[model samples]
Target: MWRIFSFPLSQIHPAVLALQLHLPNKHMVRFREDDIMSNIVDRERDKRTMLTAFFLKNKADETKPKYLYKDFPKHYTWNGATRTWTPRILKPQRGRIVSANPAEGERYYLRLLLSNVKGPTSFEDLCTVNGVTYATFRKAALEIGLIENDDSLSQCLTEASLFQFPNALRRLFATIMIFCEPGDIRKLWNEHFNAMSEDHQLYCQSVERVQNMVLTDIRAILQSMGKNLTDFDLPNLTEEDLQYGIHREVQEEYGIVVEAEDLCAKDELNSDQKLIFDEIMTHVDNDRPGVFFIDGPGGTGKTFLYKALLAQVRSRGLIALATASSGAAANNMPGGRTAHSRFKIPICVDNNSVCNIKKQSGTAELIRSSKLIIWDEASMAKRQAIEAVDRTLQDIIGVTLPFGGKIMVMGGDFRQVLPVIKRGTRAQIVDSSLRMSPLWSITKKMRLTINMRALNDPWYCGFLLRVGDGTEQSIEGSYIRIPDNMTIPCTDRQNSITELINAVFPSLQNNVHSSDYIISRAILTTKNDSVDEINDKMIDMFQGEEKVYYSFDEAEDDHHNYYPTEFLNSLTVSGLPPHKLRLKIGCPIILLRNIDPSHGLCNGTRLICRGFQRNVIDAEIVVGQHTGKRVFLPRIPLCLSEDDMFPFKLKRKQFPIRLSFAMTINKAQGQTIPNVGVFLPDSVFSHGQLYVALSRGISRKNTKVLVHPAKDFKQPGVYTSNVVYREVLLDG
Candidate 1:
């Protein structure tokens, strides 16, 4: 047998290792190649040739099967015969346009040629010599009218379809696609473009050219929808365009437009309401802007007065921008928007922060022309948010007065959720409230005495007042015992929850899938865990086949993946959809994101699950002005950076919906329901929460509260906490 040598070993023989001949020392010895050849055959080169030939034969054999070298999941299978990878059957992508333009056709042809020939991208790459093919592309572009004399690159882009170019122009291509596609860009511009004046557009164009400016007047308008100057070409949008966009947005997002018959609603106002309405209207009539606050608990017909005021101003053909601090409240008022959305208030605000409104902008025009601005649920907003608006308004109107001397009607029960200072103490929370703002001193106080919710039941009204005022007889400092009539009598906590559910959602077995019946009431809770528990129980109770949807959760920051998939799956947090979302057909669900406001698919919008498909589901709006309207919902990427519960920022791409059978008290704050069931497994940790939860019911008869008793007290009676900050309630 011959030994095969590899690399450096080929130069050496075993005879060298056996040599003991000494050249420099007594023990050294050496042998010649002939000595080794006498005992061995030189077959190393032959063996090497055989191995090389074997590998070459395998490489050149085209008939042999090939398999995917990369490992894939079970769902993806590799076929050796076809040398292809295939996935399990899936529905084709929807709303995707394939044939966009001549450029796309050319690109497709190029791709086909490359596939067939397995050639390089360019002819130069295939050729042994360097040459140019720029003329070829230019000629093709000219033939298709994509290039013409005196045409700028921007102009050419506007004239051509997005798909005409390859993927190198990612941002520009995406923007163009948005303009042509059935999405936000077209919807926003088309609805508001004509409303902009030519001069305003010119002004916006000039401002947009200022590269060094911190924020331009034109960008202010476009930035509301995450749009920027780069999204459009020359002759950019004017201030008028931006204003119109805001107007259309307010129209679509709030669904609060006042109709001809809406003016007649003023005649139905109560005496207290009529007085406040007249007092506010007096300021509008005098052309003098005034700040007024309507102090009233929930169910006091506050929203009724909001409509009356909107009707009065709009009936005269004057603009009355109605807004609320919360989405649920915004929906209640016609043409209402959240204060932040309408004012373009910064998400993070400080004392020096002004709203993103510009003096030369369309929003400024709307504000200047508006006779009144109604901000409902004002108390829930941070004091800085209110001041930010005031500063921006004063700057826009060029006035040294409050809110730029604009007639502002702010309404909310201060007794409800105050400014939420995340993890702040009582002092911090009270100080952050709108009542603590400097504008509060100038605000004319208007109180709504009569509780329209408990109009027929004085007892319920009194109970709510005591709860709000902190006069409720507490077992300790803040803990109080629930009155008998307000609670469902049950010994066990589980039984109490069952009774509470039965009270709010009666005939569930029969009307489980009824959108109207299901949304008629909801179980309100203080904690997410309790809300989830109740939702699970209600979903299980619903009569239908359940379809489970899991979210793709990951960290937003580029850090270590310390948080595992299982950990994220088990999290229960506010303003986040669950990891496991189980829904049944016809079950009521609330939208977690604002998909389309014009179609009434805004946040806080209630919809019923209709059908499910790949990456999407069909839902019909069961609440708000667009009720009965069916819309398709797709899994969208969602991020929650504002929430501080998670260590690192969390991101989840999933359907933006959650079961509506039960929701948190914070979510139910600005909403009013005919029948409300308050399930307090744990006492409320924030101020105004208990009051907000209890006040959601239309009347005491329709509302029922069940609180977990104090530890070691396993009785039917309920114990609750009243978190009121007296400092915030004090008159400035």
Candidate 2:
């Protein structure tokens, strides 16, 4: 009879000690464990029986490895003395290399090594051994491939059951590994660790754990990222650490340097400008807080006076904060930024809103140090935005005085563009202006009558003032006739479009590719539809390979009802690109998003397309201080929240650029171009639309009008209607 014995104890389950199997007449039978162990093995057949039983007990009976008793040596052979079988050895597989390039390998290796970096000395030594600067180390770590393509530290730690470094250092460096802004991180580390004394560095390296070194870097990084550092329970850094960070932030933000020679000489100020300048300087000399609103039409040197004031205060070593309502206007001012960006004002402001500023914030400290605050284009800002800054100022300076004891100088032409209130009535629009604010009661009013752009063409400038004031005679139903010299008439729609295009884009055959030439002149339209029509027409005229781009449009969420794709493609709105946007290599495009203001990718910035990729467009800036600088713009998702326009939340992914051949009048505001052609295919829809459009050209000779005769006009002439809210002109 055959009996079972254990083959090897290590590979056997503990359940085998209590189990036994029996077979009789080739039929399997069950027996007790004592019966199987007590019987000693005597033959090869019995050894095979023991191995088969062991394998069957561990897994399923039918799926067990089948082998004849004589064929057991082909797989596993049992040792007569040791009672154990030796398994066949297998070959090890080679791993595929993720990075074969030496540079890429170094980048991966550096990231892995830095992931365990603990102290300043360790980090410094790592950089030394690598023969790379701290900036280079940061750049290597920040390379997208290093983190995404390589094995993750977390995955490795999980597999190894312990991190490569101490737990505290591991966790801290893990966060640094994921930091997106490498330049900001590098700057933070340089500012903190590099400036530390040798004794303090030693103490952090030897005495305290890695958390202390990591905490210091994180605090500086958070502060630079515009986060309130007070929220974190961090250890107190040195006074220099606190002060240098604030100073660096402020310097980077408001640090405008105007060459002393670039400033307009004192003798260059006209009589009207001199009067306003003298009054402003008197308030500055007295060191008394005052709120003054300087009103002037477009091209009347409001920006010139603003720059002069900035230069004067900055030359005197006094803090003067210059900000504008629009990015274009802000770019023209030395050391200027948008008021909302500078003051941390909420984007969507209401009556109860206040600036998002804390008493101990860097912004508050900058304001406290400032002796004057100059907000240009004040009339264009919503009253709520202005009041928000006022409330925050009062809270920070600990004074109820206007603007918190800081002299406030505001300037803008109300006749140009007032506060934009979407779908608002005339009353709603007029009430949103800065003049309607509660603080307007204590303001001093100053007016400028001279138009610097039209100094040699006073008659044309006077006509513009009349057009802005609505004093110009209405030809029929709020329409006015365009002068022959300032307009080119056409007998047909086709002829009219051709004539207008030729007049604005003269010599297009020679300069279509020139960025300077393209931006020197642009056609203005009152509506976005007309702008698109003109842009498509102009792109057809440009000589280059045109690349067409289509956006991915969809509902924000797909829950219950599914909207048709065809219906989404049919929708159009302002402040958004069309479904199909076409561009040539040399075509100029305006940015729609403020992606990187430091790199001049702000809204309203004009760039010339240099090249195109699948997801991004390479372009060179042709406007503002960053002119000739090349930048890459990627396609981003944008959503419009106008419930009045769409039934559901709609998102479109497209490049943040639009053709610059023509733009809406609302977009043309705060811009001064060399030449402008107002294409009045449709009349102005709201107040100040006509003023903003007609005032863009630098001079009357460079400006022209091509209008389609107003509907129902009995008079035989082109007509233009001016929009003005007289209530905004009222002074408290």
Candidate 3:
């Protein structure tokens, strides 16, 4: 008879101990041992006997039992002296509990099981649960000799245990069962102990420290819910640990510190401005969409507040853009662009043409990347035009829902001029108008208060605001006394108006640094005239002032300097003299196209001409950039076709000679002129038109408006006809 002996025991036959342990379970006797050798032999044999007994027990328990003991092999010998069992080691099977006690490496095996059950798990998750680094785990596996240093089995195991913990651990248990037999666990323990580095050994000493603080915290929480540590799966533990760890890591990594107040204060703002700013900031903070309408009479610092908000946005690293309905309005504030230009919206000519082609092109890509857009002079933009921009933005940014990408700020007085379009019915007009849209509807309901206007001025601000609302006694005002120091006379309407033009033109030309002294006029000389008559008049005007104007034919063929010479010659043929002209490199010019009213020529319809060069017989007009399309205009006087007509019906040359006069209100958008001359002709004085024209010239110090009689000037809405009037008093 053989007996197995464990440490410090050598007195018993292991086979006798095993037989004794099994004899009782077979009958009525129970096996017990005081000696270590007997205990070792007894336990091993007991396992074998139990295995056989379990088969027999199942046969007895089942109603229809299969034959089992007939196929069972004979039991092996047990030696007490060596504590050995003589049966082949069986493969460890997955999901089978090898040990129930926590003391004999049960916790370590449990962790391995959990790791295998979870699939493709993160090291962070494992570290979070085990309170150990990947390096430490790898070193331990190597020292234990469970895996070779070159095998990478530990790393593979760690990688496979990412998110699914219980699953990964089960798989890991199955894997260990394949490689590790029941007899090999002792060898594994010795290898694991040998693999520990000095630091890891020291860390192992503090394992209880980590387990007590971190693991204990988690265990306690789970235990309160009646869960055993063994039953607490790794995934739940990982999630709990990871959330806490991530917060701690982020705080450490970013060094984030909360402040008591915002860095920039709003102490300088007025009540209304402060309210608007606060509202905008609140929306930004909450990531909500907000639309604000700052409606104020002229001179109310609406632009100033807009700029301040832009600065605030920039300081916060947010992208922002500003636009206006007209170039003049865009120029009202610094760094502003026309809405059409900013959004790359096409100027509508043919009703069927694409209204916003740029949005479909690369320009949309650019606009989508911007975080904020501010549109001024919104009143002048047609509903269709605004809609086109909105649609384009929505398409480019993939904003299926409303207000998707960035903040949009639109500023304009609705009383100003409406957009100009050619052929649309009343219903179409109503559908496409900006003021009638859902956005505007909501805005009107919100009733965003005005920030600045004439109310700020001591003399005219209050009066204009009241009159603009149509609540004042009358829209007219008495003629105020003109200062004696004013060079231009303000007595008679036309004289004062002409003097204002003469004074302002030189200043404008100088401010723009234009070297060419070119002044083209399109005067309405007759109510009814044939195309021939208009042509004859144009030719007469061209030939009338040869000394002042040199024809293109008269220009010398000096290619090196011909551009300036040819430009002068063209102007000279048009009644301007070369000697009087001062053409500068960067001067701004306006080019108007002669429209056939009978064909669809209209007041609001014109080409925006930029960039200029002089050729041999023509002046090359840069309609866009060098990369854009360009055209050449002959120096010779050209005739208008009989088909040419104005939208408003004027005689030939009614809006004649494609005059490039001082910049018009539309062209002057988004520009700041040191000196401006505003002509409020009686014909151009409707409530809407007045606002459009007045607002074009923004600076009070250098802006002047010439009107018929001061009493003839009428207030139609909240903004003054005198838009350039200063809010602050100027001491001369």
Q: In TM-score terms, which candidate is top?
A: 2
The model with the greater lDDT, 1 or 2, is 2
lDDT of 3 by residue, 1-732 (tens): 333324311133323322433342321223344445456556655554433343334435455423222222223233446434244256422222122111223222223322222221232332233344443333433333222234233333333333223222222322232322223423332332222222333455664443333333434333322234455322123333444523221222123221222223355567776777777777767766655566654455566667676666655665556666654354444444555545555655222223353444434544654555677767556766666666656666777534344566676554443454335443444344466655665452122244243234343443333333433452334122221232244477545645665555544433332223322121111111211232233233321222111221222243343232212322322212122222222322233332111111112222322322221111222221111222222222222222123222111111122333343344333333335555543334223343334333333333455544334334322212322211111110
> What TM-score number comes out for model 2?
0.67
lDDT of 1 at 100: 17
Off by over 4 Å in 3: 1-268, 331-335, 349-362, 403-405, 422-433, 444-457, 470-681, 692-732
In candidate 2 the C-alpha lDDT for residue 172 amounts to 28
Clashing pairs in 2: 22-29, 480-720
TM-score, candidate number 1:
0.67
Off by over 4 Å in 1: 1-257, 557-560, 597-599, 643-647, 712-717, 730-732
- C-alpha RMSD of each candidate structure in angstroms: 16.8, 20.4, 39.7
Residue 18's lDDT within candidate 3 is: 25
User: What lDDT would candidate 1 get against the real structure?
Assistant: 0.65
Error at 307, model 3, angstroms:
2.3
Better of 1 and 3 by TM-score: 1
Error of 2 at 531 (Å): 0.9
Candidate 1 all-Cα RMSD:
16.8
Please tell me which model should have the higher TM-score, number 1 or number 2: 2
